[model samples]
Target chain A: MSGGKLITGFAVTATSHTLGEYRARGGYQALERALLGMKPEEVTGEITASGLQGRGGAAFPVGRKWSVIRPDDGETHYLCANADEGEPGTFKDRWVLENAPHLLLEAMLIASYALGVRHSFVYIRGEFDLAYRRLAGAVEEAYGAGLFGKDIFGSGFSCDVFVVRGAGSYVCGEASALITSIEGKKGYPRNRPPRLTVRGLYQKPTVINNVETLANIPWIIAHGAQAYRTFGTTKSPGTRLVSVSGHVTRPGVYEVEHGYPVGRFIHEDCGGVLGGRALKAVIPGGISTKVLTASEIEPHRLGHFGDCEDRRVLPQSAGIPHLEPLVFEGESLQAAGSSLGSGGMIVIAEGTCMVRVLQVMLRFYHHESCGQCTPCREGMGWLHRIVDRIVSGRGRPEDVDRLYEISRANDGTTICGLGDAAGYATVGILDKFRCEFEYFIAHGRSRYDGCLECLGSS
Target chain B: MKHLIPECEALKARLPQGFESTLVLPCLRRVQEERGYVADGDIDALAQYLGVPRVQIEEVLSFYTQFRRQPIGRWHLQACHNVSCSLRGAGSLLDRLRERLGIEPGQTTPDGRFTLSTVECLGSCGTAPVLVVNEVYHESMTPEKLDALLEGLE
Candidate 1:
């Protein structure tokens, strides 16, 4: 609550909130400065010192990504803004595009200048027409203002941002997959080492930054590294836009410092769960990560882990949202065994059948599987079918072990994180809530005792 | 409308030759944006300008949900039918629109005032149960809002 204005620095102004409004409010001022006065390395150094990390789920350091791009090597270096915000329950980036398009545009211009790239693309999801339109409109506005096209702000540095629409693939959110999509290919993720920064977007050095991460850059440049660092923990440094959803009374986006407590985010910011229902479980990051129960939530106060010694604490990337009227925690969620993915906290209220909930999620992962990887495609379908059988009251005891086996084999075999996501969800639910699963298998009913009629329908 | 048509023609002239696939969809999108739907002659003219086979252009246009193959009403109503929208009562909203429009999905009303269509996703999931009338997004849609929205169009 008490922090310098890093992420939400320009969010409050009413008129300049739109692209035209942003230009009037000195929105692309940083890009002009970067192009006119500073060298690429100087801009990169400022970002490195600012401690900005990729906000597109991975949380990779932005400066480090820029450092990897060698402008002197001089192939066509690409700068991609990862706008494929497909993570379940996360919509903060969409809000940024809708409200502050020029911020992201300015950030990209600065980033492209630092990377010495002329051709940059923002690979936005196809579903985000509004964002696409806003970005396109912003680009035109910037061009007309002579703030984006050649010799921007009277400097020799030149860069152009093109918006490419993605065909609704979640995997494309990954940097490699995003590059592939921009290259007019199927959006499958590529292996690293020959990473995107080294060989991306037509085999050139490309720096891919998330929308929120790029939006933070203009502020970082304007306010200086120390000013940016004043907000969050030393390692994390700066505010983040957390998209809190689920059973909470006021489920919406909140701009909080990096190290803000999860409990405050949930109880104070999100207005707690509706009807005073007990918090059953929380999928911290996105649904991809494992679930954390109440006991786990109670002890693990959210903070940044900057040093190697700090690794003992919880990783800062795990999105923190407090679940009130604590229902499940500790060994229960760990027993469920899912990681907190993209801070897409879905607080399952009490009385909702656990098996049914898992089934719905399983069906989603199953349907969304791109089918390129055998383990993920086949294994997800297998788990979904088994969960479906169980939910429909025809589950066999062997189905539990089968789910575990399929999930284990699926974990590391696939090309992308989608495999791990499916594996984690399946194994986490079974491991953390084995008794509930067993009760369903034996009695052909939910152990929660409130949803008998809901069960009867299945 | 005439001013918009000349603008469309200029945009069509800018399409690169032999790269018909890329320009076709964008041209169709432009025409739809201006006129509310892509008329057949417009598609034919677009095909001629881009130097692509009309069938190829038509196929690509038909593939994307955003491309309207037939002439619709003065206003276009696209309801979001993706997972988030589905969870937030987009189905009920669509049902209400269909009842109010007196036309089923993909059909324009008899008065040529509106056309109803269900789209994959509109990407405003936070404000779920959303719909787009022309280019403007209407969020947190209800039956009452739908009625008011239709009335406003009139």
Candidate 2:
């Protein structure tokens, strides 16, 4: 709440997306300064010092990722801008694509130079038409202005950026799957002992970073590391774009610094729940993360890792509308089983059935599973079928334990993280809402009929 | 062997070097866009153009849900029936569409004007119960709106 915008400062302005308007707002200055003044190593150094984490739910250090690319290994180096944001309830990447396409271009330029990548690809989601159009226009403008192609701005660094559209698959967002998709395959994830850093596109060194993470690079390079560090907590030192939706009165994307309280994000930023309904649950991240009960989230506490050693105590600025920073007092949501995955904050109000929610989420996993591993392919369908049975009138009493057992079995057995994601989603939902599942099994109806009763409950 | 489609040859020529494998998804998309579905003839033509096996091409086509092997209706209605949309009553909407259209999700109407399919999340959760009709998104959909949309389609 107290932090200023770094990545999205130009999003709300009346400026057109032309290079002229972007230049007027101090845009591309970072790319210019980094290209002219700083060494490639220094650019990576500044990023590492800033403690910027990957915004694509992994939270890995951005600098460390850039550092690993063996740019001088005598092999072709490729950089992939992971814009294929397919996680449910996450659309923050679309903002940069729709509003500030040049930011991404500039960031890509800096990243390509730092990583020694000559060819790059923006693997965007297929549904993002406006983003694709805007980015295509920006790439054209950059090439026309000599920001791309041979001898960019007289820096002698040449890179070509291509925007690739994903056909339609959530699993393609995974790094390996994205690589496979780029290779014109079926988007099935490859087993990873040889990570993309070593052998990627065209069997070359590749570095894939999220769209939001790359957007932050221009800011860190333009502003010094210390200046960038002043925004958020020490460990998570950046403003994150949180997409808050579902049952909130004013659901949209809000750019809040890391360690901002989740309760404040809901009550203050999102205008609280719709119809003044009592909060039942909150999916703090995307649907892939565990759901947290309303009572589990402490009010005015910045959502951060509680048991993890990376906890930072934030200060309560004047008029910031929060209590003392949500410190690592005890076991927190991460300890209770959840993560800040992709910052897709979905607030669930009272009268929404947890069993129904799990069923819906499981259906998505079942549909999106690539069928590579048997455990995930079979387990997701089993979990979905069992949940569907429970939601309907034909659920057996033993189905709850069966659901838990299947979910546990599928967690770590797949070649990709989709298996773990599909398995772990049942943890918090079943743990917090066991009574709802029991209610559905006993009475053949939901404890709350918030949506509809069309699933054969009668 | 059937004659190769001219569009497939043109698309193959347009692809960048070393990106031959990357042509499958985009080529399939293009074929679907022009022909309404990926005909078997296009696959054979692509196999010839890209020099990949025909079974290999079929395998790629079968993996992604967006590709269709047969013809579809003029207006393909892809309703987001995933978690976010379902939480907002996308199920009831789907049921209404099914009842009105008198066909299942994978089936097209006899008149070939509409085809309904329930898809995963479309990344438009802010506007839940979203419907994507022929690549254009119609969000925050309701029963009346669906009826009006169906009426306006034909």
Candidate 3:
């Protein structure tokens, strides 16, 4: 399908079946166009105009990120694509890597040209063997095509990309932690000050872009600034791959123009909830964000869309948020104390227990906690135990208040976002679903039908 | 025998001179990359070169999932048994492999052609119920595909 048109190239086709298919579909035509004539700044400007942003949860502008890496540093600059997609309910990057490997490679090459980087790495999650292999194969294909190594498109700019596997650690999704893992060290996050763009990966200036962020580069370069900014709202522009899973009939990745309505995407694109079950709640941006109930999604107020002025142009401000009864215009879902994280929209169906869901999420955080900070290490385990007790038919009215206190203490004290994830779940569930939790505690079972079964299986 | 004795003697020269904590893992990794498994004396030499006690290196080799202390088969098949993969039938895949190979999780075939092991998360939860054979990932595995894959490998 011709999803969109490229300025310097032909139509952007979705022939992402294989590497050869991608090439035939005019996948790396932008990179060839770029190497033939386009200057580095020209590419960066085009991306900036396109309003592309990091797709690995933090929606930072891609153009701004490229502009930050000064060429005068004279040190080897690294382009690390954060493919460690650990966010629950998010599977878009994997699909891209598996299907459209060349797109990512082409984007990385263009990004390297912009940043004057010679070496790059695709930091894929260790478990994503398919993505890792596909990326590795794509790199080899690029090398064979003379798109990488020594000289690219006969332009003196030489770049080599490697795919590095990360041992299963969610914290490695953080740039510093990723760098540490690449350096063969334990994947622990470093406090930000020098920032990754300034001093990262062997203490040299580095730019860490998300998989989708890099994938957007070729599109930006091929489509001029004005052409790329034709879609989405004024601030956020461009199309994004939204990964919607859980309780939806048509759960999969959907590539939509920015500013697309959440209700439209969910009801139309996803075929609505399975069995026509009413939506009970939704976690808009992955599992970390606060949960919003069905009432919140009815009016479509809380959904996140790319802010843009022009029609048909999409920008980097693309995000995932639950559609609420409110109109989503200027205000951000994050302003409501929940972020549109990684475009992982998990829908909670009617008869699904919210407290049980929170308990499951809490258990995940507890297991994944790196134990670097005292609060996260200790607090997560404590929360898990308390929730376990409650779920096992043990009751204490004060436990709800205790859960809030524990989550509050762990929120800002951790070395990474894991603490926040645990804390957010704790606070969100307690505040929004307290009655359900209380009912469960009082009756030693869930108030919702089949909730006990859900708890048992979950 | 004389050459071996002299090399052993050179170990004394190597032991104290610029002695550093040897990364036996890297050496073992290199050896495995080239030969697929550690040889008899490679471990001892690596220990001597690293200047750490042999048992320490052995403990490290045994601790991590990547390093295999003993000889493995030609193909190392590790099925991820973590939550995500488990939720998607990774355990069943393991069982299928075990039934076919006639061995348990850590056992190698008598012919030394394949070894089965269950690992923690391999990070591809999006494509659950995955396995890695000689570091090549096979995703969304079904019983039929597993049988075909095993047969092809053999």
Candidate 4:
């Protein structure tokens, strides 16, 4: 097995975030090992070999991203950790920042060395109060120990880490917009013919990785890539820090291996849905990815999208675990028409209204649209207005089709993923729960009480 | 606004080389830190101090939602009305604050003790129903808890 767990394998005391405590738990060894022993190509090669996927919603492989920037490319490259954890339900990166910040700093240093980056930056969100303080404090500590500055570990490779905080803009979490924010401009996302890896921050080659994605680099470097691959499934190859909220009984961050069943994670690890009510739906990631109904998540047990539920037929099904009901990792969930995005699972209970849920989701997309593209800017507001009127007792049967039309309009029409993502969440909910929207539009009110809270069954 | 000269100078002295444009957000943060909000006079002085145009400063504060132009009350209550928080009674939570303060969102109380506004997300979804009073976060808040929080503020 790998030396320590992927991240957060240490006993977290009150002072564990300190450099001394971190070193005691073997924290900066990955950077030291990579700097003194391995070449830059080898460091990135280990990451590529490990198959570590990006934890920021999109499951892009981390290795493919690093490969874009050649170490000997003869250009000033930048490394950025997107610490703006603005996705509504995702706060796993904040866990690494508040309690395990040195892990991130050390990981960024390893990545910087690999990418030939002289200077790197972390564009943290402005609203992150404690995470900012802890990260800044860790950076100061790393500098004090000579771990960050000139000739780190006497490898003759030098890099500096800068914490450039954002001023409460969600779109800045996007790589291009984040670089733009760092350049001290309005946080509007730019067109991307030149990927950030090609012409990025200051018009130079830059590599931006999500905080959790970068946090895994030290582990991959410390242990060989082959050892790292042993942790999760062949494709996913690591544990994801799932931040569950909403109606879960015990809601917080739990590190689930990629092949771990989603049902077990929610039911056992998270203490099941709140008030012990029947499960209604789960927003598998943030409000961006598709929402999975209870049956969809437990598709093998009760067939929603045509997986065998009959006991006689289930025994013959080869890869499908009918008895266990496995919805493991990204591909498994994607098969159920959703993605394990950013590992943010918001569990919705039986009594919750889908219209109210979509209204909240639409309102978020509308408020956070950055207004860079006309499709997203107009489509988001239009989607929100339609849902708002439906919740406000204005009955129109045409509204559901209009919602679908608006969602269809947003697909691939915007510069950033926010537009397309908002559409995914809307269509996902609408696809699963069309009757609720239709009922609300026809009757000018929600079929249920519009209750999101789980008042326990009497 | 004239009292913010020292803060502006401090911001100017610390900006990274050739990245004077980066001073935009930090400068606005500084002004808001000194004064309760970024007034028009403060923006003019900041633009002049940092040598960034007034338009850049204007677009900045206008873009980021946290930076307020007008002066707000002592206790700025930001209730998260996003999915997780909304699922956990953030709607009624906002309603309760409105009843207690006798002011809707974007309005301050008659005495200027409280100002209410709904934020998109505070990222504390685990402890849903989050309410941010100034910089601190009050998570999984109830109407009773909010009432107590308001009482203790004075």
Question: DockQ of candidates 1 onward, in order?
Answer: 0.16, 0.47, 0.12, 0.67
Regions more than 4 Å wrong, model 4: A1-4, A302-326, A455-458, B1-16
Cα lDDT for residue A368, candidate 1: 67
Model 3 agreement with the true structure over A1-458: per-residue lDDT tens digits: 21332321233355454567777877789898988888887777777767776777768878788888865467667788889888766777887787777888888888888888877777788666667677888777777878777777778888877666664677778888888766545567888788888889777789998887777777667767677778555666666676776666666666766566566667777787656766666777777777765545554543322111121231222222333442222234554456566777766666766666776677777777777899999999989888888888896888888898999998778768789787886787666667777777888876665241111122
> Model 4 compared with the native: what TM-score?
0.93
Model 2 chain A lowest lDDT segment of ten: A310-319
Better of 1 and 2 by TM-score: 2
lDDT of 1 by residue, B32-104 (tens): 6677677878867776665667776665454434556567787888886644454455667888887777888
Per-model root-mean-square deviation over C-alphas: 7.4, 6.1, 8.9, 4.0
All candidates in order of TM-score, best leading: 4, 2, 1, 3
Per-residue alpha-carbon lDDT of candidate 3 for residues B22-41, written as tens digits (9 for 90 to 100): 22433455555666666657
DockQ of 4: 0.67
Best by DockQ: 4
True contacts kept of each: 0.06, 0.45, 0.06, 0.73
Docking class of 2: acceptable
Q: With candidate 3 superimposed using the best TM-score fit, by how many Å does residue A261's alpha carbon deviate from the native?
A: 1.7
